[model samples]
Target: MLCFGFTFLYVPMVLLIVYSFNYSKIVPVWGGWSTRWYTVLFESEEVWAAITLSLKIALMNATFATMLGALAGLALVRFKSFRGRTLFGGMISAPLVMPEVITGLSLLLLFITLGQLIGWPTNRGITTITIAHITFSMAYVAVIIQSRLTGLDQSLEEAAEDLGAKPFRVLIDITLPLLAPGLLAGWLLAFTLSIDDLVIASFVSGPGANTLPMLIYSRVRLGLRPDINAMATIIIIVVAIGVCLAGWLMMRQERQRQRDMQLASGDNIKQD
Candidate 1:
């Protein structure tokens, strides 16, 4: 069953990667194995521009989402009793359940209203798209962070406070470091969602603000081409590399944490 599931998921991607090197212009008809489409993709200015724009938006969205989501998570976890806490928590999680079309429509209206009132963001482009991505992406980040905080041992933080550390100092020294894995995971999730988004981006973007997904969708509408296959292959390779790197870092951190715990246990045994 596991092998069947893996095959179901990755077989299409494998086929797409294989056909990216086809010499034929038609996507389905493989003339012969060649790197012609890759060269064409590299030389296309429009594709490159879209790729650049998408990456910029994804990076900004991930960063802002991580920061805001971390703060929200801290608020929900750390502050036990606060006025309107339920309302605030509900708002933070709303985007997760909301439909993308509705979210996009609401944000579009918001930008339009803001423009009319304050004359800010007169045109919707990267700025608007980044904001839109962050809105929905942060919800996922917040959930991850909240779960992480919930499972974390609070004794270390209490000990820090007992040792004369300020609240902020304890957070900086104890909480944030413990939250690093969660933060990294949230950031990567946000980045991937932003890059993969099309519905929200389409609603928020203006002229000449095409993202890679937008460009790909438009091209696919016309017809599939060998270059499109090549682009997908490149994206798959980059994402695979990123996932592997993140996994390695996470494993290394976990090993170090286990070692520290063992050493602490040994010292306690000696003292006893």
Candidate 2:
């Protein structure tokens, strides 16, 4: 089942990557192996602009989403008795279950109304798209952070407080360090979501603010473009490298955590 699922999901991407090297403009029909498509991809000014715009928005969205999401997650776990906690939790999570089409349309209408009323965000473009991405990406980030916090041993925090550490210091010296992996994962997820977003970005993006995904979609609508396939291939390579790095980091952290636990247990045994 796992093999089947892996093949089902990756086979198409693998085929697209393979075709990206083909000399033929026709996607399915291969003319021969060549890197001309990649050369074309790198040479296109519009494509480069779109890529830069996408990266900028994704970075901004990831930063804002991770910050807000971490706070929300902390609140959900640490302040369960707070006023309107139920409502707040639901609102924070709404984006996860909500349909993208509805979210996009509503946000578009909202931006239009706000622009007319406040004379702010005077136009929809990179700022608008980044905001939209942050809105939804933060929800996913919150869930990840919340789960990580739930598994953490709260006594470590208590011990820090007992040792004369202020609340803010405890967070910085203890909680945040422990949650680093989760934060990294959440940031990566937010970045991926922001860059890959098409629906919400399309709704909010204005002229001269085309994202990489939007540009690719527009081209593919006419037909398969070899340059787009080459771009996709490049993206796949980068993402794969990122995934490997993240996995390695996580594994290293886990090993360190396990060693710390063993040392603590030995200390307790010695004291007993």
For candidate 1, give the lDDT. 0.95
lDDT of 1 by residue, 72-122 (tens): 999999898899999999999999989999999999999999999999889
lDDT of each: 0.95, 0.94
Clashes of each: 0, 0
Worst 10 residues of 1 by lDDT: 21-30
Measured by C-alpha RMSD in angstroms, how accurate is candidate 1?
A: 2.2
The TM-score that candidate 2 achieves is: 0.90
What stretches of model 2 exceed 4 Å from their correct place?
Answer: 1-7, 251-272
Which pairs clash (backbone N, Cα, C closer than 3 Å) in model 2? none
Query: Could you say which candidate leads in TM-score?
Result: 1
